[model samples]
Target: MIKKTIAFKLTSGFVVIVLIAMLTIGLFFIQMFRQYTFNSKEQVLLERARSISELISENQQSSGQMQRYGGLMKALGTLAEAKVWLTDDKGNPAVISGMGMGRGMGLGNTFSSEPLPAEAQKVITNVLSGQESISRNFSSVYNEATLTVGVPIRESDQKVIGAVLLHAPVTGITETLDKATNMLAISLLAALMLATGLGIFYSLLFTRPLKAMNRTAIEMTRGNYATRTGIKSEDELGQLGSSLDQLASKLGFTIDQLFQEKGKISDIIASISEGIVAFDLELVPLSVNGALSEIMNQPQLYSNEALKKDFEDLGIYGLLEGIIKDKKSLQIFKDWKGKKLKFTLSPIIDNQNEVTGSVALVQDISESERLEQLRRDFVANVSHEFRTPLTVIKGSLEALMDGTIDQAQDVERYHQRMLSETKSLERLVGDLLELSRLQSGKISIHKEEIHLPSLLSDVIKSLQTLADKKEIEIVYQGLSDAPALIADYDRLRQLFVIFLDNAVKYSPSSTVITVEATLIKGNTFEVKIQDQGYGIPGEELPYVWDRFYKSDKSRQSKGTGLGLAIAKHLVQLHKGQVSLTSELGKGTAVMVHLPWILGN
Candidate 1:
C-alpha cells in the first residue's frame, strides 16, 4: 500500500512539475513578445514621421503647396492607420488629418488622443524643440494604449516652425502580441497534456506488474504459492517480477511439502476405522476425512464449512455453541448408523492457554464395545452355567463321601448328577470349539441337500414341551415343497433351532411362534422364525448376530449367550446370510437365507 501511494505521488508530482515549468516558460516568452511588438510599432511610426517632414520640405514654393502638404499628411495617416496632427511652435495646429476621412474635416476638430504622460511628452517635446523627429508610447482614451511620434517642420536655419505627430491606437499592435501569447499558451497546454499522458501510460506499465505481484502475495496467504506475476519487462518492474516469481517458487515448494506431510498424516488417520473431526476458532469445520463423513452418515457434513454460519444451518449448532460458551470439551457416546462410536472432543489451545476451538476424535467402538460386553457376559454366563452343574456335583460328591450310597441303585443318583455336570461342561467347551473352528477355518463344512421344512418340524416337536410350558404355540406355515438347499445340514439345523428355541422361550402361552419355509426367487430358500413375543429392540439388532451378546431383557433365561453367535457363524460358513428385523415390543422375524445352485 505504501509503495503504491508513493508511486502515485511520484507520477502526479512529475506531471505537475512539467506543466508548471512549461506554463512559466510559455508566459515568459509571450509577455516578452508583447513588449517587442510595442517597440517595433514605435520605430515604424518614427520612420514614417521623418519621411512626411522631408516630403513637405521638398514641395515648398509650389502653387498648391498647402494642398500638397495636406494630401501628403492625409496619405501618411491612411497608410499608417493613425491620426496625424501638425502644429506651429506655440501648439496651434498647422496640418491635421486622420483616417476615416470626410464629416469632421477641420483643424478645430479633435479626433485624436493628444496630451501624453509626462515621460513620453517630455521626450516628444524635447525632440520637437531640437527640430528633430522623436517617438514615444503611452496609454490612450481610445482603449488606454496609443503610440506617437513627433517631427519638427524646420526652416533652412534649423528653427522649428511646426511639429508633425503621427499617432495610432496601440490596440492593433497589442492584437499581434495577444495572438502570439495564445499560440504560446496552446503550445504549453499541449506540452502539459502530452506529459500527463506519458506519465499515465508509464505509470500504468509500472503499476500493472506491481498489481500482479500484490495479487501473488495475497494469494500466498491463502496457501496458494503457485500464483505468480507472469511478466517479463526490462525495467525495475521486471526485476521486481523476477524476485516475486522466485519467492513464489520457494513458497510453493514449502507449501507442497506441507501439503504432503498433512496428506500423509491424513491418510494414516483415514486408514483407521475411526472418525476424526477438526474445527477452527469459529466453531466451524476445518478438516474432516472419509471416516468422519461415514460416521456422520452424510458425505457433505465435513465439506467446506469454515465458519460459525455453517453450524447455524446444521441445527446441531447448539453442540458447538455450548462447548465454546463453557470453554470445555467432552466425549459424547453415540450410536451412529447402528454402530457404536466413542467421540472425544478436545479443545485446541494457543500458547496463552486459552481455548480457541475444539476437535473431535470419533472411534468406531462397535467391536470394542462388543468385546467389552462379551467379557462381562462371558463372566456371567460361565458362572451361571457352571453353578447349577457344580451344585449338583457337590451334593452328589458329599453324599458319596458320607457313604450315603453303596449299591448300584443307591450310587446311581450321585453318578447321574456328576454326569449331568460333566455333560454341561462338555457343552460349554463344545460351543467354544465351534466358534474357534468357524473363525480359524479349522472346520470345513461338507455341503449336501437338506429338507429344511422336514428338519425344522422335527426340531419343533422336540422343543414342543418347553414351548407348551412357556405358553408359546409353535405354528409352522409356508412350509411348501421348497427346494432343498445345498449346505451343511448340521450347520443349517443349528441356525434354525437357535432362532426357533428363542422365539418359543420368550413368547406367552398360546402365542403363535411361526416357522416359515418358502422358496424365494432365484433358487433361494428363506427360513423365517417369527415370534409374537417381547421383541428385541431396534438398538440390539446389529449386535444380535455378534458373539456373546444377549438382550438385557432376556438375561433371566438359563442359556449360553454364544447360541446366536454360533448360529450366525454356522450359517455364514455355508455361504448363507442371517438377518434380524424387529421393533421394540413387536414380533421379530429372523430370516435365514440358503442359496441353491441352479443345477441343484
Candidate 2:
C-alpha cells in the first residue's frame, strides 16, 4: 500500500486525536450519568421502605402478620423489574410483590438465582435488630446491580417483629451505557472517514506552491541563481515568488564575484603546504585549509565541531579574548607535535573601528625539533645513566687510597666493589646498544611460531626459587594451545620474564602473580601479565614508554629502568601493541595484543 504524505497524515492525526479526546470525555460523562441514575433509584427505594414500615406500624396484627398494605408492594415493584419480599426472620418469604413480567421469573418460596450479597444481608439484619432503617447498593445475582433498602416494622411496644426490604433494579442505566458506547464507536469511525477525505483534498490545495518552491529552492541552493518559481498569486505565495525572483536577479552578480574571489583564495591555500583556519567577526570558523589539519595529525577536528565552535578555542581559548579587548592585531604561534603555527588577528571593520576574530596558519617544523630533541634526550639520558656508576667508582677509589684496603680482606672488598660498578656501567651500555639496534632495524629476527603454554611454564619455573624465597604465589592461566606470530623465541621469553622479575622484586613478598592469555577478535590473542605490586601514578602513565623514564615510586630500586621501554619497542617490532593500566596501590596489568593462529 502507498503511504500517505505528511500533510494528509497530519489531518488524519488531528482528527484521531480529537475523536479519542471526545470519547474519553464521553466515558466520564456516562459514568457520572450512571451514578446519578443509581442514586435516584436508591432514594426511591428508601422512600418505599419507609412507607411500608409506616403502613405496617399503622396496622400490625396481634400475631404479627404484618398484613400487606394497599399499595406498599405495588409501589416498590413499580420502579423496575424487581421482587419485594416481606420475609420472616427465618428467611421464609411472605407477602411478596413484583412488576413487569420478565423471562424466567421465579420468585415464590425463594429467589431462583444466587443468594443476596453479604452487604445486603448485613443491611437487612441491622435494620431488623435495631428496629431502624438501612440501605445499600450491590450487584444482585439475579441480573444487574441494585439498591436494597430495609426498614423495621415495630409493634405498639416499639419493638421490631419483622422487616420490609425494597430492591430497586438499575439494569436500565447500564443498557443506556451500552447504547452510548456503540454510538460513540460509530461516530468516531465516521469522523475518521470524513477527516481522511478532507485531508486529501486540503493537502493538495495547501502544498501545491510548497512543492514548487522546494524544486526552485533546491536549484538555487546548487548555485543556479537563474532558477525562479514564476508564481504570482495574491497571497503570501505571491510575495514569496516575488522575493525569489528578486533574489535570483541580484544573486547572479553577487555569486559570480563570490566564485571568483573564492577560487583565488582556494588556489592560494592549496599552493602552500601549511594548515590555515580563518574565522569571521563573531568568532565563527569560516574556513579551514588542508595544511593546518595535517599538522594536528587528526582529520576528525572538522567533524567534531561545527563552524562556530572551532575558532572559539583558538590559542587554548585566549587569543580571541586578547584581540577583542586590546583593539589591536595580536599574533601567537606555538609548536605542537613538532608543527609551528603563525596565528594572526585583524579587524574586519565596516568603516567603523571594530575588531573581528583571528586567523591561524600552522606549518610543520618537525624535522628541526626532531633533531633538537634527539640531541637533548641523548645528552640527558647519557649524563644521568653515567653519573651513578661514576659516583660509585670515585667513592671506592678514594676509600682505597685512604688506606682503607690495607689488609687482604679489605683490599679484596674494595676490588669487588669497583668490579660491581663496572658491571653496572656495562648493563647501561648494553641497554643503549639494544635500543639503538632495535630502532635502526640492525637486529636480526629469527621469526618462528612458538607455543605460549610451554614458554610461560618455563618462565614460572625459572622464578620458582625466587617465589619460594619470597613466599609469593605464582599463577599461569590459559587453556588454548594457540601458536603465536613470527618472532624470536629468546626475545619473547625475555619480554615476559621482565614482567615476572619486576613483580618478584617490587611486590610484597606474599602477593600473588598472574599470567593469562586468551584469544580475542580477528585472529588476535592477548596475553596479560598482572601483579599486585606498587602501582604507577596516573600522572606518569603518559610517559611510561619513553626512554630513561621512571616513576618516582620505583626510581630508588635497581635494574635498568629501560625494561618497559625495551618491551615497548620489541612489541612494536612484531606489529603489535602493548598497553599498561595501573592505579596506585591497587596494582598493574600490562596487556600485549599479538596476532596468532591455531597450530592445527
Candidate 3:
C-alpha cells in the first residue's frame, strides 16, 4: 500500500538512465586501453627479435664468434625484458638466454632437450622461411600468457640460415590495465552520484507544479472551488492548471444558479395546497414536498425509500410506474382511510420528448367530496320537506272540494289542519332562508349588551307550554352568575329557543330538561342544554349540523330538522363554537360557546 508519487518515479528513472550510460562508457574505455597496450608490447618485441636475428646470422660460421654472440643475446634479453632463443634451420635450439638476466624473469630451462611447442614451432618455421611471425598465446613454451615473436637469421643476400625467437609475458600489461580500470570505476561512480543528485533535484522541480495542481483539484472536489494552482509559466502544465481553474469557476457558478432555481421551485411547491411528488425513471422518489408529506400523514418521508413506501402503501406506486412506462398522464381517485384522494400522474419529458421521470399531483379531496354529497342530500331533503306539507294541503283541499267532510266541526278541523301544515311549511322556509343568510354573511348583527339569566327565563317561558304537554320539567341553572354578552337580542333568543324546543320535544314524560349558562375561562359565554331522551346514535353525531339532518327518523314530525343547523350558523356568526355529545338510551347534550364581548 506504499503509493509511489510522480516525483519518486521520475527520480528513480533518471538515476537508472544515468547509471546505464556511465557503465557503458566505462566498459568501452577499458577495452580500448587493453588493445592499445597489447599492440605496443607486440611492436617492441618484434624490433628486439629482428636485431638478435641479424647478430646470430652474422656469427654462424665461427664457434668463437657464436659464443660471443650468446653473451650479447643474454645482454639483449635483460635490456628488452624478454627471453631470447636462437634455432638452426632444422628448428633445433642454438643459443638461449638464462638466469644471468634477473630473478622472476621466467627464463627457466634454457636450451632444454624437449622440443618446442606446436605454436612456437610454427613461429620458428615461418622465421626459417624468411618470414617474421608473432604469437600472443605461447603458454606451452612459457607456461604463462606470453607474446612470442620470431624473425629469420638470413645472409646478406637474404638467404635464411636460422631463426630468433623472443618471448614476453603479458602479465605486466594486464596489471597496468587493472589499475586503469579501477581508476575508471571510481570516476564513473562519482559521475553517477553527481548525476543522480541532479536528476532528483530536477525531478522534484518539475513535479512540484503537478503536485500543487493535484492538491487544488482535491480541494475543489471537496467544495472549495476557490482553490487554485498559482503556477505561472509558458509550459503545458501551466496551461492545464489554467484550464482546471476555469472549469472550477464555471462549475461553481452553474451549481449556484441551479440551487437558486431549485429553492424557488421548492417554495412554490410547498405553498400549493395539493400534494406533489417527483420520481426518477426507477420510480424512486427524487423530490417530495411538504404537502405530499402532509397528505400521506407521514412527516418523516424524507428519504427516497420512505417516500416510495408511502406511495406503495397508498396504492399509487403502480400508477407512477405506469406513467413512466407509457409516458402518459393518468388521473385516479382513491379512497384511503375514509378519505377521498385524487392523484394526477404525468410523465416528465426532456427536450427530445422522451420521458425521463414522472410527477404526481395529489389532492386530498375528502372535504370537497363530502360537500358535494351534502349538496345532493340538501336538494333531496328540500324536495321531501316541501312535498310532505304541500301533499297534506292538497289532500285537505280536495276533501273539502269533494264535500268529503260536510259537518261544520269536520270542516273547521280540516281548516285548522291545513293552517298547521302551512305554518310548518312557512317555518321550514324561514329557517332555510335564515341559514342561508347567516352562511352568506348577508345577515348583520345589531349588537347590544344582554343579561344571560333574563334571556334564559324568556326562552324557557316561550317553550313552557310545549314542555307541559310532554310532562317534561324545564329547569334553568347557573345563569344567575353568568356574565352578560354582546349580541343581537333576537338572534340570542332564537338560538336558545332552538335548543330548549329540541329538549322539550325529545324528552320523555316526567323527564327533566336542564338548561345552564356560565362564563367559562372568563371570556366565553357557555350555554348547555341536556335532556333525558332517546339520544342520537354515536356514529350519527358528526352530521347533526348539516341542514335538514335528522338524527331520529321517528321524531321527524316533532320539529323542522333545520333548527340545529341554523343554531350552529348563528353561533359561528357570533364568533363562537357549538358541539354535541350523546349516548344511546341515555340523553343528549348541546353545548354552545359564544365569545363574551366584554366591556360591551
Candidate 4:
C-alpha cells in the first residue's frame, strides 16, 4: 500500500491534469498544421488548373477545339505535379493532362472522353455553376492521399462555359506534417516535464503549512494545548491557520475556566446543608452531590451512576416526572431520619422556554416546623388559660348581680372565688411576661456567689407546704457546707421552686421528691431533681422543654404551663446546661450543670 500525503496527492493530480491539457492542445495544433499544409498544396493546384482552363476557353470559340488545351494542361500539371482536366458545363470531361493519364493516375482510364466519377462530378458541377470546390479526401480517383479542387471558366461575356478540375496527391503534405508533429511532440514532452517539476514544487509550497497545522491539531487532540501553526503567509491558508490558532487558544482558556467553576460549584454543593441535584429530561442524573446522597439515605452514592439508581429507589423519579409534566415547581415535606425535610422540585427551563430537566433542593426543616407548631400551641394554651379564669370571675359577678346569693356567707364565698380567679389570672400573665423577657434576651442577670446548700434548703422549705398538700415528701440530699455557685440568687431560687413544685404536683402521694446538689469535676456544680411519678414517654421527652408542653394534660393542676420552659430558658441565660431523662412507667430525672465561677 502506498501512503499518500497531501503533497504527493496534489502533485499527482496536477500531473494528470497537465497531461490531459497537453494532449488536447497538441492534437488540435497537429491537426491544424496538417490541414494547413494540405490547403497550401490545393491552392497552387487550383490556381494552375484555372490558368489552363482560361487558356483553353480563350483559344477555342466552341467545344470543337477543346483539344487545344491538352498541351497547356500537360505543361501546367508538370509544373504543379498534379492532374488537370477540362470539362464542359454538362460535367463531360473533354481534355485530360498527359502528366498522369499515361502513368495510370488520372480520374479514369478513358481520360478526355470519359465521364467524370461521382465524387469528381460533384466538383465539376459546382465549378460549372460559378463556384469553386476543394476536397482534402479525394482518394477514390487517386492511388495516394490527395486534395481536389475545381474552378469554373467563363467566356468574355462572363457566362460559364467549362470547368477545370485539379487532383493532387498530398504525399508531400503528409511528410511535412510528420516532421512538424515530431517537433510538436518533443516540445510537448519538454513542457510536460517542466510542468511536473513545477507541480511538485508548488504543491509542497502550498501543503507545507497545512502539514504543520495538521500536526498541531494532532497535538491538541493529545492535550497539548499550547501548540500553534506558525505559518505567516498572507494567503487564505495562512488566514485559516490564524483562525485555528485563535480557536485553540480560546478553547483552552474556556475549558480551564469551566473546570475551575465546576470545582467551585461542587464545593458549594457539598458544603451546603441542603441536598442539591440536577437531572436531564431522561431522568439520567447529570450531577448528584454528597448532600443529595445523605438525603436519600444512601450516603455511599457519590457518582452519577449510583445516584440514578438511588433516584429510582427513593421514588424521586415520580416527583421529577410530575414537575416536568406540569412545567412548574413543587414542594413537599417528608420525615427523613427523624428530620423534617422540605424538598423543592423545580423545572429547568431552556432559552426556548421548554422544560429540559429538573432540579431538587432538599432542606432540613424539623426545627422550623417544631417552632411553628410550638407557636400555635402556645397561642391556644394562652387562650385556654385566660378563658378558665375569666369564666370563673364572670360567673361570680353574674351571681352577685342577679341577687342569686344574697346571704352573707354565700356573698362572701362568691367574693372569695372571684378574688382567687383574679389572682390566678394575674399569676398566668406574670409568668408569660417573665418567660418572654428571658427568651428574648431582654432580662439581665446580676451574678453573685450563692452557697448551693443554703439555696436548696430555702427552696425545699418554700415548696414544703405545696408538697404536703399532695402528701409527697420533699427530701434534700447534699453536704450542708458544699461549695457556692455563681448565679443570680433570685432567679436560681425561682428555678428551684419551679422544679420542686412540678415534682410535687406530678408525683404519687407518699412518694419521695429528692433534690441533690453536688460538685462534678472541679469548678462545675450539678443539681439533680428526681421524682417517682408516671414518667414521660421517650418520644415526647425531646419536646418537654418547649413552652406550653405538658406530659400529662389530663391532670387538672392549677399551676401555669410555663414552669419548665421558663426554667430551661433561665438556666441558659445563666450560662448553665439542663437535661432531663425519663422512662415510661418508671421515674424522671432532671440535671442542671452551672459553671462554678468565684465572684465578689
Candidate 5:
C-alpha cells in the first residue's frame, strides 16, 4: 500500500499529457514532411522531363543534332540523379541514358533497342496524348522502386510528337525523409524530457503548501496545535494554507479553553464531599472522582474495568444502564460496608435532547442518617428520664400532702428521697448542657499547667469514700513522675471523677481499681483506669461514646449513661483521644491520651 502523494499524481499526469502531445505532433510532422518530399520530388522530375522533351523535339530532323542532344540528355540525367527516357509517338523507346548506361560508350550510342514495359508504356502513352504523368512505383522499367514523371514533347505549334520520362529511384526521397524523421524524433524526445522536468518542478511547487498543511494537520491530531504552514501566495493553495492555519489557531484556543474548564470542573468535583462517577452509553465507566474512589474503597479507580466491577458489585452498574437506556433520572439508596449511600443518576443529554451518557452523584449520607436517628433517640430518652424523676417527686409530694405517711420517720424519708431525686434531675440537666456545649464548641477551656500527681490525688480523694463504701481499693500508679498537662482544671477533675465513680460502682467490693498516668512518647499524658468490674460486651464497646447508651441493662437505673459520652467530648475539645477496651465478665479499661501541650 504505497501512498501516492498529490505531487506524484500531478507530476505523473503532466508527464503523460506532455508525452501524448509530443506523440501527436511528431506523427503529424512526419506525415506532412513525407508528403512534402514526395511532392517536391515529383515537381523536380516533371520539370526535367519537360525540358528534355523540348530539347528532343527541336533536334528531331538532324541525326547529328539528335545524337548530340542524346549525349546532352545523359549529362542532364546524371546531374538530376535520374534516368532519362525518350519515346516515339507510338510509345517506342528512342533513347535511354544515365543510371545503368555504360560509361565507355561513344557519343553515337543514343538509343536503346529494348522496348518499354507496359507500365512505362502507359505513362509514355499518357504523356504523348498531351497529358503529364507521375508514378512512384514504376518497378517494371527500372527493376527497383522508382518515381517516373512523363511529359509530351510539343512542337512550336503545341503538337504532341513523343514523350520524355525521368525515372528517379524512390530511395533518394526516402533517405531524405528518414533524415527529417530522425531529426524530428530527436527534437520530440528532447521536448518530452524538458516537459517532464518542468512538470515535476511545477507539480512539486504546487504541492509544497499542501504538504505543509498535511504536516500541520498531523501535528494537531497528535495534540500539538501550534504548528503552522507558513505559506503566503495569491493562488488557491495559498488560500487553503491560510484556512488551515486559521482552523489550527481556533482549534488550539478552543482546546485550551476546554482544558481550563475541565480543570475547574475537576477541582469542583474533588471538592465535593459526595462521590461522583461518569459512564458512557455502554455503561462503561469513563471517569471516577476521588470521592467516588474513597466511597468505593478503591484507591485506583482510574482503571475502567475495576471501577465497572465495583459498580456491578454495588448494583449501580445496572442502574446506570437503565438511566442511559431510558434517558431518565433516578435516585436510589445503597448500604455498602456500613456506609449509607444515596446515588442520583441522570442522563447526559446533547443539544438534540438525546442521551449520550449518564452521570451518577453518590452521596455518603451515613453521618446524616445516623444523626437523624440519634436525634429521635435523644428526644425519647430525655422524655423518659424527665418523666421518671417528675413521677417520683410528684408521688412523694402527693403522699406528704394527702397525709399518706403519718409516721415521722417515713415522712422524713420521703422528703429525703424527693430531695435526692431533685438533685439527680439537676445533675442530669447540667451534664446534658455541658455535653451540648462541648459538642457545639461553645464551651471555652481555661488551660493552665497543673501537676499531674496532685490532680490525681485530689480526684482519688473525692471518690475515696465511694470506693471505701464498696471496700474497693483505688490505687494510683505512675503518677509520681507524670508530667504536668495544659487543660481546664475543673474539666480534667470531672473527667477523672466520672471514670473512678463508674469503676467503683461496677466493681465488686474486694476488687481493686487502678488509675495509672504516664508520659507516653515524651509528648502525650496517657491515663488508664483499669477496673475489675462487670465489663461491657465487645459489641457494645463502639457505642459507649454515644449519648444515653447504657451497656448494663440492670445498672441503667443506678447512674446516668452520659458519663463516657461527656468524657469523649471533653477529650475531643482538648484535641486529645479517648478509647475504651473491655470484655464481658473480665474488666474494662478506659484510656485517655492528652497532648502535654494543648494548642490554642
Candidate 6:
C-alpha cells in the first residue's frame, strides 16, 4: 500500500472531497425543500378555512338557518378541495362534506356525528374558547394526515357560538419533496464523477516529472550519471528535474576525469623496473606492484606491516625511518636474499609543503656490485703481472751494474734471463691490449666461409712443437666432412690456437689432447677441446672467462691468465657461446658453439 504513489493518494483524496461536498449540499437542499413544501400546504389550508368561516358567519347573521349554512359549507369544502365539518354550540356535528361522504352537494348522515380525534378535539376546544387554531393532525374521518384550522362561530352581538373546521391531506407535499430529492441525488452523482475524472488528470500532470526524476536518481546510484529527466514544464517539478539532470552531467564529467587520472598513475607505476611502494603518514601500505614483490622476495607483501617487517629484517628500515622523521630523501644499499638491493626513500609533501607520506623505490644492484669488484681485481691483477716481469728485469740490470755477476757464464745467463723477462712483459702487455680492444668493440671481424677441418689442422700444426716439448700428443677428431663456419679467418684461427695451447700447457706427459669438431642441433657447430690434466674446481669454473682469472695460478709463469678470457670474447664477437665443465683429478673440456648458418 505504501508503494501507491502521491498521484494516487492525491486523486483519491480529491474524489473523497467531491463526494462529501455533493452529499452535504444534497442533504441541505432536500431539507429546505421539505420545509418549503410543508409551509405552502399550510398556507393553502388556512386560506380555504378562512373563506369557509366567513361564509358561515354571513349566513348566521342573515338568518337562523343552520341547514342552509351546512349546504353552503359543503359547497365551500368542494371548492377548497378538502373535507368540511360543522358543529353546533354543544360540540355536536351538523354537516360533513368531502369525497365518500358527499360530493359537496348535501349533508351525509352516515359520517355519524363521530367525536373528533384528540388532536382535532384540542384544536376545536381552543376555538370555542375564542382562540383561532391551526395544526397538523391525523383525521379519523379521512384516515390520513391533515392540516386542521378552526375559527370561532360568532353572532352579530359578538357572542361565541359553534366552530367550523377544514381537513386537507399533506400527501402532495411529501410526493413533491421526494421527487426533488431524487433529482438532487442524480445531479450530485454526475458532479462527483466529473470531479473524480478532473482530479485524476491534474494529478497525473503534476506527478509525471517527479516519477522521471525518481527513476533518474535510481540510475545515478547505479553509476549511470548521464541519465536525464525529459520533463519540460513551467512548474516547480520541472525546475527540479532540470537541476537533477545538471547534477548527473556534472558528476559524470568529474568522475570520468578522476578515472583517467587514476589510469595514468597506475600506468606509470607499472612501467618502472624498480619496486615502488607508497605509505601514509602512519606507515600503512597503500599499494604495491609486481616489481616490489620480487624485490622484497615476498610475493604476498601487500600490507604495510608485512613490507615494513621485511625491509627491517633486510636491515633497511633505519634508512626509511630517518627519511620519514627528517622529511628528506635517503639512499641506502642492503643485502636481501643474497642479492644486493639499493633503496631510495623520499617523503611525499602536500601543497602546503608538509610531509604527508613517503615512497620507497628498490632496485637490484647485485650485478653492478659484482662488476665493481671485478674492476678492483683487474687493477690489482694488471699491476701484479707487469710488476713481476719489471722486478725481474730491474733486479737483473742492477746485478750487472753493481758487478755482482763477474763470471762470463753467469753474465750470459743473466743476459738471457733479461731477454726472457722482456718477452714475457711484452706478451702480457700485448694480451691486455688485445683483450681491451675486443671488449670495447674496437676490433671488427671479416667474415668468410672457411672449412672447419682445414682451420683446425692449421692451428694444430702451428702448436705441434709446443705439445712435443711436454711429450703430449695433439689429436683432432670428427674433422672429416666438417661443416664450414662463417667467421673472420685470422680470429677463428687464433681462437683455435688459444684452446689447443691451453690443453697442451695443462696436460700430463704422454696424455693425448683431443680437439673434437662436430655439427649439433639448431644448425650449430661445436668444438670441444678436452685435456687430460688437473681439472678445475667446480666453484672456479664460472669465473674462467673473467679477465685475469686462471684455474692454476701456480702456472702463471707460462702465460698471462687472459688467454681463455680473450678466447671467450672472440667467440662472442662471432656470435658464439663458450662453456667449461670440470671435476677435480679428472679431465676438463672447453666447448665453443657457433651458429653454422650465420646471416642466412
Q: In terms of TM-score, which candidate is strongest?
A: 4
lDDT of 6 by residue, 481-576 (tens): 755678898998999888888888777888898899888885888899998988888878878888888776764556788999899999999999
Superposition TM-score, candidate 1 onto the true structure: 0.48
* lDDT, candidates in the order shown: 0.72, 0.70, 0.80, 0.80, 0.81, 0.80
lDDT tens digits by residue: candidate 3, 35-87: 78778888999888877776665665343234445557668789878877777
Q: Lowest summed-lDDT stretch of 10 residues in model 4? A: 101-110
Residue range 1-600, candidate 4, lDDT tens digits = 223677778777887788788778878887887778777787788778777767766765544354445566677768768777776666667677773332221223334355455568778777888998987674644555677789887777877877888777887565666787787778778877887898889988998899889998998898777889998988999999999899789888988899999999889988997888888899777776677667656648567777666556657789899999999899887766677888899999999999998998988787788889888988988999999989999988998999988999999998999999999999998999999899889999988889988999999999899888878888888767766677899999999888888888778888888899888787778899999987888889888887777876862678788899999998898889999998775788999988887655
419-482 per-residue lDDT for model 2 (tens digits): 9979988998899889888888888778777877778788889987888788888898884576
Whole-model lDDT, model 4: 0.80
Q: What is the TM-score of each predicted model, taking all chains together? A: 0.48, 0.45, 0.58, 0.75, 0.62, 0.58
lDDT of 1 by residue, 221-250 (tens): 887877888888878889888998899899
Residue 382 in model 3: lDDT: 87
State the displacement of the C-alpha of residue 216, model 1, in Å, after optimal TM-score superposition: 6.5
RMSD of 1: 13.9
C-alpha RMSD by candidate, in order: 13.9, 35.8, 10.0, 5.7, 9.0, 11.7
Residue 359, candidate 1: C-alpha displacement in angstroms: 3.8
Could you tell which candidate, 2 or 6, scores higher by TM-score?
6
Candidate 5 local lDDT, 102-183, one digit each (tens): 2212233335545555567678878878999987763644454577789997667788766788878765556666787788
